[model samples]
Structure formats: C-alpha cells, structure tokens
Target: MRVLTSTLLVEAVTELSRGTRLVRAKEVLAWCDRNQVDCQGAGLKNQALWDADLEEAGGPHRLLKFKSGECKQSRVGWALIAHGAKAREAAAHLGWRELRWTGENWDWLGGEPPPPPRRPASREAPAQAAAVRG
Candidate 1:
C-alpha cells in the first residue's frame, strides 16, 4: 500500500486550495484509492495521516483533519493552517466548535518554523545607540 508521504499530503492540500476549500469525505477516499493506499473502512490506514505530531518537510504550516470518529465519517475533511495558529483557529475553520472535535488530529508539515517577520527598528534606536557608545 502506498504510504501518505509529506509530498502527497502537501500536493493534495495545495491542489485542494490550501485549507480554504472544504473537501468531502468521498473525495479524500478517492485520493487514497488513486494513490494505491489502503483504507481502514472509510479512513486511511496510513500512520502519517493519523499521527498528531508527525513532523514532515514542506512549509511552516500544518495539515490537519477534523476527525469525529475512528475514521473519516465526518463531512468536514482537512485543512492546512499556519503552524503557529491556535487550536481554536483550526477548530473554527473546520466548523467543529459545536460538534465532536475532541479527536482533531494534525501532522507537523513544513521544514522550519519560518523566521519571524521583521519589523523596522524605531527611529530613535540609532541615536540612542550612538549616545551610549559615546
């Protein structure tokens, strides 16, 4: 059976709109079938897909599933959220706030946590540094 590698996962997510698009359970099943992956009932049996803490190479983001059962029974499917985005953000995006969200699972996609965005230094910093040096 084909394993769900980071590349396939990333491609699937990217092709599906990077989490902005809501994928159905059947579509996910089709992906597995097309890739020659084995499914456990209606869900994938791949460890990489089920592991909540799986680290893989891609971007500074995550690929997660909103699981309601042991499988992909839930209509809500997957999303790719920023690594630093809060659990609530994921929960909200997947519309699981009022549903069975306890088993939400995720994989650590992306290589390094991206460098923090740089902000311009304050106008007074150079003057202060020069005075201190003097």
Candidate 2:
C-alpha cells in the first residue's frame, strides 16, 4: 500500500474541494491512524470523529481552519474530503483548483505545477556558495 503523509491528505482535500462532496471526520481520522500519523498533538481536540464537512471549504459548520500550533495545522481537511464535501468551494478557500481521489489516494487535480527537478551540483556550486558565504 502506498502510505500517505498527513500533509498529502490535507493537500489532496484542499485540491478536491470542488465536487460538492461531504466527507466524514471519522473516515479521515481512521485513515490517519492507519497511516501511522502522529496526531496525538495535531489538534482535533473535542470534535467527534463522525463530524462531516464540505471537502475543502472553511467555516464553523465545515472545515474550520484552526491554529494547530506554531506554523502547523490539523488534518481536519481530510475529514471534509472523505465526507464528499463541496470540492470547488473548498478548493477556492484552499487556493487550489481541483481535487482527485481514487477511493484510496487523493491528490490535487488542477493546481500549481509540480516543482522543478533537483540537479546535483557539479561538486562546485555547493562549495563555491559555502565559500562565498563564509
């Protein structure tokens, strides 16, 4: 099985928030647990696992964005996606275009193109940069 990171799941939901789907919180929680996510301190405080939210939108009744911690956020977005929450609206809120789910894996549909490939320095740039900085 291709294990998914919590970040990926969150990003996927953010991407898929345009299809009017309502995903349950429990489903997301279950997926996180199965994927060995360390959510013990990842927020999600008192909300029930069964709570449903529109895939990617943000509101009190839906996927409310909470300050998980210093520069971190919760995976509540996954719950929203699993429940088939509104994808387009949610994607708008998340600044994504579309979402894609294959009943197991989720990903962005139409968003920023992937990052450029990394190329190893010819054993020169790194040393030169370091030397220049030093």
Candidate 3:
C-alpha cells in the first residue's frame, strides 16, 4: 500500500479549488485511487476523507458515500478560514470558538484570546552599558 501524505492531499484540494465547480470527495478519492494513493498506512480511512472534505469546505457543496451509501453533510473544519497549521493555530488561539462539523458550514469560535505578550528588552546589555557609562 502506498502512503499518502497530508501535504499531497492539501495540494490536490488546492488544485481542485482552482476549477470553477466544487470538487466532490469521491472525485478526489477516485483520483487518488487511480494514482494508487493508499490511505490504510496513513491512518486515514474513508471516514477521515469525508471529514477532510467537510473541514475544508462545508458540504453537500461536496459529498461522501460509503461503498454502502451511508452519507451526510455539514459544515466542517477551518479549511475555509485557513489551511494546515494556521487553521489549527487559529482554532487553538480562539478560546471559546471551536471549528465545528456542521455538515454544511464552518462555525468560527466567537471570542479570540489576546495575542501573546512580547518579551522584555535584554537586561544584560543595558546593565553592561550602564557600567561602561559609569
């Protein structure tokens, strides 16, 4: 089984987004299958793929059906707001807000925490300069 990295998936999604129409998860899955991209080793299953689609874009803007045909849609992930680390950090930094799986929408957390405090200036250099001046 070939291992597919999240980076490759991100690239595929980015490329797909450039087209006029919204790309379906199944379509992306088919592309990956044709290319022999395996998810088994990567710990990503069909469910995870579905989750990714929801996270990236709130769906039935896209869809996912199991071989069994069980499916649902909602707003998912922070993909619309930000991708990858930035998205994760945004979710983390925003205190009360959670990136929810709405099946058709991404709900941003309402409140955001203040940015981290800046460090103080170097005391050692200032002290040394004071001594030299004296």
Which candidate leads in TM-score? 1
Q: Ranking by TM-score, best first?
A: 1, 3, 2
What is the Cα-based lDDT of residue 43 in candidate 2? 43
lDDT of 1 by residue, 9-61 (tens): 65565565544454444565577678775434245454455332233322333
**Which stretches of model 3 miss by more than 4 angstroms?**
40-134
TM-score of each: 0.39, 0.25, 0.34
- Please report, in order, the local distance difference test score of every candidate based on alpha carbons: 0.47, 0.40, 0.44
Candidate 1 at 120: error in angstroms? 56
CA displacement after TM-score superposition, residue 126 of candidate 2 (Å): 80
Prediction 1 TM-score vs. true = 0.39
Over the stretch 59-79, how does candidate 3's per-residue lDDT look in tens digits?
Answer: 333221111111233222223
Return the lDDT, model 1, position 98.
18
